[model samples]
Target: MKLRILITLSIMVLAFGIVSADFSLKWFYPEASNSTSSSDTFSIVNYDRMLYGATAGIYNLPDVNSVGSDPDDYLEIVLGSDELKNVEDTTDSSQGVWRCLDAEGNLEWAVGTGTDESRSSVAILDFYGSDGLPDIVSGTTSGWNVEAMDRFGNFLWTFPSPPHISGPYAWHSSPAVADIVPDISGLELAIGCNAGYDSTDNHWGMYCLQADPSDGMDDGITYSGWSDYPTAPGGTDGTDWDTIWFHPTDAPVISAPCLVDMNNDGILNVVFGTGWQGGIGGSLGQPGGKIICLNGEDGSLLWEYSTGGSYPAVSASLAAGDIDGDDDNEAVVGAYDGNMYFIDGDEDGDGTISGSEIAIYYHSGRVYSSPAIADVDGDGDYEVISGIGGGHLKCFHYEPSAATVTLEWYVDLGDSIISSAAIAGDPDDATPWLFFRGNVERTAFYSHTGDVLQIFISAMRGDNAYLYQVRGDGTVMDSVRIGEASYASPVVADIDGDCLLDLVITGANASYDSLFMIDFPGPDTIWCFGTDISIHGCETTEFHPQISNVYTEGCSLVYATVCVFDDDSNYVRGLDISNFGFLEDGTPIVPPNLEMINECPPETAKVDVVLLFDFSTSMDDEVGLMYTHVPEFISALRDVNYRIGIMVFNGCPTEIDGICNMVKTHF
Candidate 1:
């Protein structure tokens, strides 16, 4: 059988501009008043069915509502529990419009409806309620309360009973909950409250309470002074909460803790920072600011990182992601020292950030906001987005190898941004745009390559909030008035169920206290084609010298089939061996004839070639010549496929009729 095979090769080149796409603003809603600051990042949760946010403005306040207050800073929830339907018409320019308002002509679930700066960020838990939907939990910074509620705005329970502290600027920590304990069926929400008492000892660190959904407050959940701790630091006997992890710093832990599987070993750990000092220069030697990592199972020290300055504190919260795609989590944190750090969650399986695993980047001003990580460039690597007090939004390409990170680009937003920036658009679609608030001036958007795709410049000489559509080439297409004074980072979602993603954002100043939605009517899908190659062997041209077997010594030798066509035969006549064109090292190799080279050999040969000579006649002369040439002839046939045989006869032959008979045979 003839061996059949052919090899085809192809190299595919990827086209550029596959990632750059146009992202335009559809529409935006505005706030009703100018007294509130919606500073919290909206958490798009409940499987994207609900959007939750809070507002906090005043740097320091004695209580949630004091002498002067903006009552519009409340937790707002917009729900789309029912499936949204769209218009079937395809040819129409406006295919469908979003139903933002509910059947009752009101937005869904506006709980905590008052003007107290609720700074604690909202976290949506997968833990569901009796309604079979997930719930939202958050703590109030000024209110000094921790609470959980269902999706429909029903209050589950509130910590500290009254949800208010008597001291000035007594801030509560953001709630970090997880199913930590072994036997607990529900989650345990942990917080660090800065209720500074006169005596430092009275401040008994981090507090974790049972926020059980089933029991709510019925499960002996209440707050008291060291009553939660029987051993008591102040010589006062008190009951300690179920799990009370003491903060290392003498001061109260104001910074919220983040629970994550830092080591990726199926176990969780708690990471947080503490310090009241706004920046490194002021916080020096405060003893309140330090980044601490602890075990989640039982509060134990995993590792602790400090700036090593007199007061190098990490007052901002920490963000975690596997920026290197190595399945290892790294802690992304901004510090009062004006430096951003990337700490490897675990190195050498020791559950600690080694000296080599830590990488740092510095900004012109201190970073109060956390770093946001995403593959903004569609390069499969995450870029760190951080807003600094210097009014600059910086992006850094995270390269964990070689112990270095490089800055990609930074934009001067022209305002001291304390809020973390938000990133939207899919990297698979090759379109990632960053949205951030730059004080009272403007809300800007940009492509991953540091290009200004769109800019919503706050109008001149007026309290104007304009939303502008940006072209892919960094040009403003159109603008519209949306709201006023926004500090909260924008959140992206398909709220109207129109298939295109919409923007959900709120403002810091209370002109619009409620959450706003900008309907996105732009392209949401990307098209691409994969590359493939194929090949087939030559059909008409038949190669006679087919390779049968290959043998190799120092050099390789290939054996092939040798064919010789006979005249007037079925095979084509006048087959030329020179037309065979075999090449070795770019030199033509000519085939040898069959007899010259052992191209064709018979299976059997030399049965017998007998010679009988008459010794009585002139046999002497013939015998002499035969003896000389016979040895040489035998030596020549030694390498070939032939052997020699000889016989001698002395007597004459006696004829017997038609058959000739030998006279005598001698051996």
Candidate 2:
């Protein structure tokens, strides 16, 4: 047997347009000459602007200080520059640290540290000193060396690791600051360092320190000077440090620490990255990358997740945000393999949480940069943003209710974006604007639709930093650039209480890192707001009838209907099959039962019919018996006589001329 199948296909159309509303942009002062960075300033007012970035040649490092006084009268930035001397014709490209300045852009004092070995990383915190002066806390290198400095750049104290806890490598991640006071009394600071090793012969581990601001010891402060936080379980085993991998050619050790609040419980959390050093046989180790989470108060292990495979991609930096709208903060980590993971946190510390998954593009090139999250779309749901080795900015939005993630957009900056993204604006906006550095030489602004509105070029290395006034449609109303060669992210604040926002960026140059403050006039008055309404077409009815098979017996007929509706569930329109014909043994059966025949109702409505026939010979004896008996045969058709006709044939092929005329005359 052969069978034929019929298939039908339909397509739908959708329309979109800009909504109704107006937005505006305004610019204030511009801060100039910091180090290279992707950072921006936050705001308590309506006025904000971008500062100058550091030059590529100079090693001036600038750090954006914490908010002080009112949101407007806060710290702008501070930086210090140092020159690098060439050794054996090989110039040393190392990292440096600088001071943070106030909004006035005055020299608040500067300090520089690190030897020829070069500093791997630095973290700074703002605090009030016992002497009633503003003090700063900083950490660097792998030696567990943490220091506190007075506002005058004088080193007040330094904390060292215990004598029994000796390791070959130093700390890579920066220190995190927190106010442990119940309401706001005492300020406690925490710092984490990498303590583990790579080879089986030597194990590596992690260490954290809690320091007291009152004690001032500069030179050789021992662990007794500060409180010692316990390490993770099994972290002290000699095998712990042995997992470190080294590059084949460079043999660089890999580990870095990130500070965050993973549980949204108003407490700080610590996350550390561990993996084989890239550039060597880094792929040979099992569980090549691991992340351990610890409570900031006592350094107790909250949870730990390991990447179980050959050469799991690992990132040196990590950021935290609520990606799934579950109120629980999630950690965004990058990998050397260019993979990004969104590890959900268990707020209750119940040990049950979502595992890590590749949420961003994994480049074949290394991804040492960290990931940033913000609600780029003012929908209250945060979007994950990260830069790759080849300079690609990727964004993702996770809708937890649907267990689905949507790729919002991406852009290629043409250079490595080692830094993260900064998103800011009113939470009520449908689409808030975002700001980030493309490279050290240029800073660019983009709309939510991935449209590039403006590009500011600060130096040959590219604008290291940027600030913007974003409109509703994702367009940048205004933007400013700082110096070049930036690797830090921009921060937003209200430095001057004009009800607007201000920008702060950090970067380094050849020598000293300088912080600049640019103040915008007032709030941008021109606002662009959009509103949209969905519309649908309504369904109705239309008709078309055709006649077929006209003979002495009767005439056969058929009818068809068509329906059409719009996307907005409105204006529905269709057709009804009100007419039709039937066949008996390949013979046309006509309309004596025309009024008795069933009619097709509207497609949207349910339709039913019953057919009745009289097989009595007495009825067949009459010439028009079939037509007359049809009405009597079916009780439902007693009222209207739509059109009556008849037909009769007995085992003979007889062609009767004028069949319609004969039926009309008889009936």
Candidate 3:
């Protein structure tokens, strides 16, 4: 059948420290897959399959761990069906959302959001039905429409049966779900809607509805709140968004709603900002937006605070922390008017908060980046961090003595900041790292090389420098205190011919020489021991033999050309391949029929031969047989420097291999 199979081979020289995959694999990216990785970060799902969104349909990069992978498996399955039953929309304009079911690029299902949906990120939640599968929910940009579908692509429900198509509506605000009623059973979805440009405009505000009906019979969403719009405002005559109470906003709410217990009550509360296009309302400037906190149970306003200025629409999100010395959480948000506002949730014990309750820090340009209130320096007190449109990220804290906010530090990032900063683990226990020219890159900034996972850093202690190896598992495995302080990290390579990586750390605060080169045996799993490896009586460290060519003889017998090399990749001359191995399909081909056609054996190798045979008169037939083989035996040693002598005994000898012993003693 002539079976064609994928081949895998590896060569492991455990003693001399050389390990490599013997076969080859080439990597390639399909040009027709997608243009960019989309504005949002690429998403990974279903066992390392990466779904990259674009203006066209989604491209799934299957098996992220392999090279030369084929990513076009599902591309053909999609764009050919009208329903896009498993992958993409037939109409290219309605690209839709897709789910990669496995690493083979098979699809679970795809649902089109219609043309020009401008949908926000989809959330996978288990709030749909008793089917025991996740329900996918997504809202269109601006208050258009929102859909919740089960894992099988079956539509569960759509809000506002007659959905609003387009206007100044849903931006990038995602749907947030939380346990709204402390006494109730199920959860609720809190959506912050987009208000109009003018202050008097209505119809857009906050809506809270039961995500999954507790009755189990109801197949759609029903509002839950203190108000009775279903039985009071009209008496059982209402629509989808009418069951819950509504609170109107002055401008569009572009940020996703954040739900938490604002005042430590048992119930959840929604906190979000209201804004639109940042600073684009030039001559007739746009109305400013406000940051509001609403009771999650009833849609009642807990507290609403407006930013100072002709408040430009603040598209930035909101964050909460204890800004003041008082441990009550305050709303920290950035507005488009170039400021970070810290609004106290409950100040002055009054029903409404008006003056001295809000504090502002001028950040210079439009602040679209949300403020994060965290103890970023691990100093017991919390600091407010945010960035502005002019590319400056600043940190500030409240001072009771000065009765105002004070700036701690700021750095220019060389670009406008829109994304929020994330912190992991304890701030005091963080290890420092030099960014790939300030940040980790996909399209690398420079072609310089090392290993990104293996970090080498040097520290200055007293008058000495300590070189340390920081492993990927966040542990310091090895350390050495050099004689001088080094301002740089340790650089490693095979600096000598010993096949071990050597370190070169340049000194900065010098008490000694500027440069010190040392053998770096720290954290390296492979180490070459001793001066030279003579396992097969060959200088392997100085002359390691590797298979250079492989072929077959008579279509059955396999052959390989082995060559010896030094550290400089130059051919080590005058060496013969006495022993070598070829790994085929991870198994060595034993007893290869090797023919050393091109070899230069040592010239000084000497050979001496002594022949013993019977020359008795009773063995004339045997003596005549020896005369025929003597010429052929001498011809076989033509390539050898040898001296031959024959000893004919009068009778037969005793043992088979006694010729060498008798010649060494009596002869």
Candidate 4:
């Protein structure tokens, strides 16, 4: 009888211990010299059973040992082993990529492809390939690069892209990937690019690429070709290229592109960021931001909206997801002016609504980083996760049925969070985590309960580092530190065959710039591929210029012509004067001879008029008005020649339609 009782007690105790160990949270802070603040943060993800992260520079040393003029340190999670390896060189700019590893840190892998020292910036990755093999794609300073390798890091085929310039001015934004075809076609890829330099000429846009598994090459080449989409209109030679359209707006530069399946269609469509004008700066001679939407397939303009008033001089980042559980996606955009916007509605995805509706707006004076979209409340709907320039993190919730968005929670970090937030763990889980970086200081984590989980700070005087990580809750995790400074986000992956998650970060230190990987041990194998979902369509609104009409006395009646240009001064179709007419206070005017404008007498017209047309598809009504008015005026003219002229305006173009000269002729 005594033995039986003892055995039963032992079994009960063992079961209790297992439950606690499996679900409890633990924090591990590696001992470091007191002088070194363990803040320069990184990220971690759990796959088969592993933890991973990257440490900037070496212990006690502030510099990394990488190759090329831009050297940096990178840590990666080894897949099949319990190990964290740091790859450093003096000549390569390889710093950003997603990493993963096994529980013992024995195996690891990273997604991103680039030259040893030139191209090394990884954006986002996932398990999207058809062969079930993990693939990786990265955006370099020059162009987009991709590669498929197994857990052993064996080279498969390398994807190719258009050759880009390689210098201070030559660079590409991060690449975003997704599985658009599900079980068959592998994954598609999207990359952001800045066509030129300088604010006026900067051409910001996105490129879509489909992955092909059959191409086998190792010479930094890609089998997937690129689509010849029209360049975004606005600015000059393509300079301040930041992101693509994810919402709706009037300006091309202000749009941000994201991938999602808003209508539950098997094909994932691209969502554009709307609101705001002129990225880093406000519009030409004006201040404030505007949002514009575009069709992902043909880069056609959709709808446009604005945030009202001149912005405080900052760029904007976008986030999207189903926020209200209404089976529709909502958009959240962050601006440097310390404001965040929430746009709701169907956004023309063939759902409950066709146009976007404003759900809410929040103002946080601090410059805002990119936003993270997730179901932070675990209510089956997503909340807006954003960081402010003042180092504050906030979450906003939306109730579609009520048409309202309310603030859920907020936390201040005492520093700016320039990077977007990354979410880990299942949404339905009891506990989930959110991760983000504090500018130049630390990487912090928060639980679903709005409690601080852990804070990782970096040592000063060494490298300005960017940190990235994955949330495994209590399972497994990983993180990595790439360089001394970073303007890009970090990526996560399971590198080795260990089934754990790893981290990849890209940035530049005082010595050089490079992409680094950090491997951590976890519990499950993580697979990732390089692909992107396409954007289905867009919605646009008529553009109304704040300063639309300018009246000048004694200007010119001679020959006047009207022309239309896009945001970048690129001429738009159907802007010809032959298709438009003018009305003076509801009075119809005759169509003037546009071909003879320069030779016509300046006094006869006396009034110089220019029309600023919104080229987005949403402006169809406005464009149609011009056509209707023009023909009516032509009929009213009666005389063949009239002293009048017209001009079209967009970004910088003074005239798109030819100059016109009109002379009154009577029988």
Per-residue lDDT tens digits of candidate 3, residues 105-206?
Answer: 234345554422333434444665555555555555332455555655555665543333332333245566656754445556766565333445554566
Ranking by TM-score: 1, 2, 3, 4
What are the TM-scores, per candidate, against the unseen true structure?
A: 0.52, 0.47, 0.46, 0.45
How much is the lDDT of residue 52 in candidate 1?
A: 16
**Model 1: worst 10 consecutive residues (lDDT sum):** 526-535
lDDT of 2 at 536: 18
Off by over 4 Å in 3: 1-87, 92-109, 130-133, 151-154, 162-168, 195-201, 214-243, 278-286, 322-327, 354-356, 398-404, 425-667
Report model 2's TM-score to 2 decimal places. Answer: 0.47
Error of 2 at 237 (Å): 22
Query: Which tens-of-lDDT digit does each residue in 1-667 have in candidate 2?
Result: 2112221213232221111122222222232222325562222221111111121111122333333332433433333222111121223222233344555444344444332111233333335454444554454332334455554556655444221122223333344445432233345443333333444312233444333434332211122321233431122211111111111111222334455677787776666566544211332222246666766555567776554334553535566655665666666666665666556665446654443332333455556555555545444455666566666556666654444456677555545555455444431221222122221101122223321211111112253433333332234344334334444444443333333333444433222224434322222111111112111121122322211222222221211122233344332322222223334545444435333322233323311222222233333343353444333433323222211122222231122443334333443
- lDDT tens per residue, model 4, 555-612: 1111233222234433221112332345433543333433233321231322222232
What TM-score does structure 3 among the candidates reach? Answer: 0.46
Worst 10 residues of 4 by lDDT: 8-17
Each model's C-alpha lDDT? 0.40, 0.37, 0.41, 0.34
Candidate 1 lDDT over 131-161, as tens digits, reads 4455555554333345565555455655544
Error of 4 at 662 (Å): 99
Q: After superposition, how far is residue 487 of candidate 4 from its true place, in Å?
A: 5.0
Candidate 4's error at 330, in angstroms? 1.6
Candidate No. with top lDDT: 3
